[model samples]
Target chain A: MTTRLVEGSAVVAEAMVRAGCRFFAGYPMTPFTEVLEHMAESLPRVDGVCINAESELEAVGMVWGAAAAGARAATGSTGQGLSLMQESIAEAAMAGIGFVVLNMARGQGDYFQATRGGGHGDYRTPVLAPSGPAEVTELVADAFELAERWRNPVVVVGDYYMAHTWVDLDVAAAVPDPPPAPDWALDGSSGGTGSAKLVSPLGTTKQRDGVGYDLAAHYDHCAQRRQAMTEGIAPRAECLHTDDADVVLVAYGTMARYAEAVVTACRTEGLRLGLVRPITLWPYPSEIVAEACAETKVVAVYENNAGQMIDDVNLALLGAAPVVGINGFRTDSSAFGIAPDVTVENLTASVQALFEQYG
Target chain B: MYHRRVEREILFTGIGGQGIQLAARTLAEAAIADGRRAQLFSSYGGMMRGGNSDAFLVVADDAITSPPVVGTAWAAVVMHHEHAAGVWPKLTESSLTLINRSVVAAECRPGTGAVVEIDALDIATGLGAPVAASLVLIGALVGATGVVSADALLDSAARVLPSYRAEAAAVNRRALEAGLATTNLGHPAWSRAEVPS
Candidate 1:
């Protein structure tokens, strides 16, 4: 219940402790390094274990091991390190062991492709994107809950901006109880059975069949759980004046804040406009967005990436509104796809042009 | 009923750890304390040390229409040469430019309006803390623009530096006085200079 001027990284750490995260394993990576440092200092105060893993791969594996042993475990890294941890993440996914992975996204490319998409498979991990300090705190709590409820890994994705920015937050109320390991978790002893039963290996025919049947049931249950999560955990999308507007501005994260300002300005000038901010990027609140598009004339998607979220917006709108993308990818040819130097002024002009065209 | 108008937009630019953020925050807090609606936003990049840092502060009696200042600012306090030059184009004819005399060397023109030069480093060192140069500049800003009252400035300082209340309070008070005392800019014809080259 202590209130202090905590940095964004420190806020995330505090949320982790509140969520009953007892085990932390991570490697040092810029921007994200602060999270590890904060955990190293605070976790021990709460009688939790914090391990500085030798490598990113080892860090994820350590969390996997800890979770299997019935402890609330977590790990974090930057883009490159997250890439190295993908193999272990996939294994954890298959095992249905609940754990949390934080990706403080930075420059994207060969050395740091994990920020973009480097998990080595087609699975879309339940990813929560937080723009500022407040969202960071709220999402961390949501991520832990989602992880434990589904018995799978929940990733809280943040960029350099969210990691470094300092914003005021009040988190004395949202802390959860200490996580208890389920009876099914592997804790080295089989309930009163003298003989050890190995449930991991799937090479033998009988073992393979047993594992297949169990995995199939788990996957089916997981599918239904995921659907409920999508409907239940869908982020509250902010729709500003979209009901009777002709042009809708679509944005998320920090960019959405700037777009909100622009929309306010445009409205003052007598231009009819509104904004749709997708708070949850993973669940991709398509239905909510489609409802907005039904009444709007045109939709413009503004993002820091080169059309990463536009595809999803297009799918949601489904030709109900003419969709245009105003992308801001780094044009410097740097490996990191840091949004090319686009300012609010640049975006204002782009929106103005759309307004004139539609008018 | 009389309609109120937005008075001004000001930008404070300097390197990280130079107290630019603090100065901006104080100004906004002071405006709010005086019962005015003020909005502040800052943009800082990878350069924590010796890197380019800038903060925008907008103050008005009414609600702010936009979060960021769009064009020319009414006044600017530049602590570094690069930031001053980078933002030189955004000055209006009546805009006031406060340059740290220790670092910047630029001739003021008619279009760019008045330029106030002060050796903030010297004044801060004399006050026994070189880091207080920002406070000196802020003090000079209050005196020059009359944006906020001197009493408001001191109140803002106390609120921002609450942790260092006992130790640095006296020096900061003196620094503000020094800023108000030294106004060496000769009156120049106010003309809006063409955008900086």
Candidate 2:
């Protein structure tokens, strides 16, 4: 394994390949386009198939078929494109076919979309929000791992910054070895046989197979699985200076890196600022955020969108401390939704202003 | 003497066709080739040419925290002055700003940082490789700050350029050497990954 200087999208593709994602599909969108390009290039080398589907709908449908055939499949697009795939994603989640969804979002606006999910019912996919390309090397592997292990879809959120940033990463180490094919897959080996297994969203297969079909039981089983997944997956986070912090800030995705940098820089100047960056935005790392802000004066959230993750922060805080939202400092809105604040100067000023009031 | 492990952020500002993108890649790939970690974030307009193009680079021996589009970078390469003003807000006292004197007016230099002026376009035109002016700036970058060796820059240049540019390698090499000749290397913007004492 060697390090290649490449972008975050390429890193995600590399990691997914390393984790044995054998089939991929997606439509072309600005930030998410590179992942599809990389997958198209790399998957063919591994005897895997990657398709640039005509639309997001076709992409998700193709992924669903591949996943049912026991191929570790994935489909991705920006949130706008992903909006079209939510119903299939919901069905796949309910049907219990595992796959990966790369939600390279417009900004942090998709926090609710990824964590809460646009899909209907009580289904939930573990959401992993990596800060940049380096983390993509690890978290993408984590994404496939959770998707397969829980037998449910997984969401890995990326923003424009995460999409464009290039880094040298060898992602093979983080990938889990692909397991042998299970008997449950629809590989056509059972087509001529009398015992044709059906992968169904409803528990109708049991009825056809002489076992009574019980829809309530299936719903209960899925709920229990989601519950188990919530309890089973350990929350991941990065914390700094929280022990002595007077003000604690919560952030995730690319904005969290800036928050982390500003937190460290502020501490040296005697500003008691700390930060909680949730690596798993779905499990939400509520405990870490609350514990870090235990004695803090206020907990502020800096997200690229309009105060979305702040709700999660508030729920994590449980009214123990005041919660505020100072939007991630930004300018120059483009069609691509590039979070173009490159330096921490604007972040520093925003952070300083927060400390003046709360710290 | 490399103790402080801060990411040395470098901003590249220019128009679409000025080779700013290639210049940024050269610096980053060169740093990686030299056994350091680097991240390059590029943002540009839709136009194929004569529109805003910029890149944010973070290089360090330590674990990169992945800075946002850099606010106040440690250095900047200004290939053109049109988009240069926005980058000025992202520089400070310790920063270094390299301006292409052939294209950027003397008054258009950034308000802060020790400025290094190079007639990159004129130099490239002189060498008959006018399109490789950004490579000339890359030469100035390596010369002014020993972030990457001149040799590594050349190797990386060969990789980042379009495959069709294979025949133009020698001309690009001359452009880099010309830019290298105009400055000396000494300023260190990084820490060696050796265990910090």
Compared with the true structure, the alpha-carbon lDDT of candidate 2 equals 0.83
Screening candidate 1 with a backbone cut-off below 3 angstroms (N, C-alpha, C), the clashing residue pairs are A329-A340, B111-B191, B111-B193
How does candidate 1 score on lDDT? 0.69
Query: TM-score of predicted model 1?
Result: 0.77
lDDT of 1 by residue, A1-359 (tens): 43233456787888789878999999998667889999999888878999888988888888988887878889988877887888777656556677888887752222123223455433345666665566676678788887887766778766555554443343476445686777756788875555443323121112344444455555555556546655666555778878878888887766676688777767777788888887666667788789887877789998766566787788898888899988745632222233434455677798889878876
Highest-scoring model, DockQ: 2
Specify the CAPRI tier of model 2: medium
Local accuracy of candidate 2 as per-residue lDDT tens digits, A233-277:
999898988898888878888888888878877877788898888
- Residue B194, model 1: lDDT of 19
